[model samples]
Target: MDDIDQQLLLLLTRDGRASAADLARELSVSRGTVQNRIDKLKREGVIEKFTVELGRGEREHQISAFALIRGNADDDRRILASLRRIKEITQVSTISGTFDLVVELRCSSLARLDEVLDSVRSLPDVADTQSHIRLRTWRS
Candidate 1:
């Protein structure tokens, strides 16, 4: 990416909701140019998704946990699917290294977290899992 592309990305990363026209003005480029650059970014998968940063109060007050899961390929999909069904599980990624899957869950309370964990641990494919409760969150 060139300087202009980098600039556009930086601006958009800070405020995904910014209008193309606004970006154009800020970047000293045409609206169409801004739009094209954004389109290119999206096509390249550089721009993941437009998201709103929700405050703790705005969202369910919950503890966040990351888990390293182990399971067979088919079991991995099933486990992830089941985890996704839980409203509290906001992020799940199939990763490399010692862990097979990395999961992030947001629970409303300690009881809710235990409930989620119980559900996950009970899965037949899950051999073992490690979890860490988030003490603080800096950003989305």
Candidate 2:
């Protein structure tokens, strides 16, 4: 919430596995101070959770796409719940525009992606969908 906390978060974002001692050394503070700050950040919900970033080798073979969905209002909950069960669908968000929901998908092959898209299309109340395959990712 303060300058020190901001700096600590920035460092953690770069390397979530950094030790308290390492952080303390970089921040010119005691190890306990770093630990306490990290604990406080978690308690206050500023640090939601730690996660891993896959290496290029692990991701290069994967195909990714975004599917924009338009569905009936009454079936929104059902449609969303169904989409959540698909392993390839990583993220979904409700949007205010032409599309009612935007779903992010990742699969090992184009055939798998098509299968997932077909599954989505068959879901009840899903009136229409437009998919855009990601050619390349320049940045996160």
Candidate 3:
């Protein structure tokens, strides 16, 4: 991507719902140019998808944590599928470290978080799990 494409992505990253006209104004290009660039970005897979960051009011009530997990290698696939079924577990990533996976959790309450943790631990494939409750989030 060129400088304009890079700049266009930054604008979209800041606000996914930004209009073509607004993006064009920000990038000092025509609306058609902005639309075409967005299309290209999507086609080339530079921008996979757009998502939302829960607002402060809702986020304040959200219990977020990262669970570092160790599990049997043979059960990795099943474990991931199970984790995906639990709504509170938003992200599950396999990483190279002492832990086999890192799971991100966002729950409605402490009780809910506890329940989710227990459910994760009970999975036969899950050998062990260490959780760290998030105290604050300065950046995404």
Model 2 TM-score relative to the real fold? 0.86
Mind giving the per-residue lDDT tens digits that candidate 1 earns over 87-132? 8888899888877898888787899899888888888788788889
Q: Give the TM-score of candidate 3.
A: 0.90
Per-prediction TM-score, please? 0.76, 0.86, 0.90
Q: Under the 3 Å rule for N, CA and C atoms, how many clashes does model 3 have? A: 0
After best superposition, candidate 1 residue 27: deviation in angstroms? 2.8
When superposed on Cα atoms, how far off is each prediction in RMSD?
A: 2.9, 2.0, 1.7
Q: How do the residues 1-140 of candidate 2 rate in per-residue lDDT, one tens digit apiece?
A: 88889999999998999999999999999999999999999999999999987777878889989999999775599998899899999899999898899999989999999999999999978999999999876653
Clashing pairs in 1: 62-107
Per-model lDDT = 0.85, 0.92, 0.92
Error of model 2, residue 25, in angstroms: 3.8
> Lowest lDDT 10-mer window, candidate 3?
72-81
Q: List the residue pairs that clash in candidate 3.
A: none
| Top of the candidates by TM-score | 3
lDDT per residue as tens, model 3, 24-132: 9999999999999899999999999989988988999899999999997755998998999999998989888889999999999999999999999999899999999
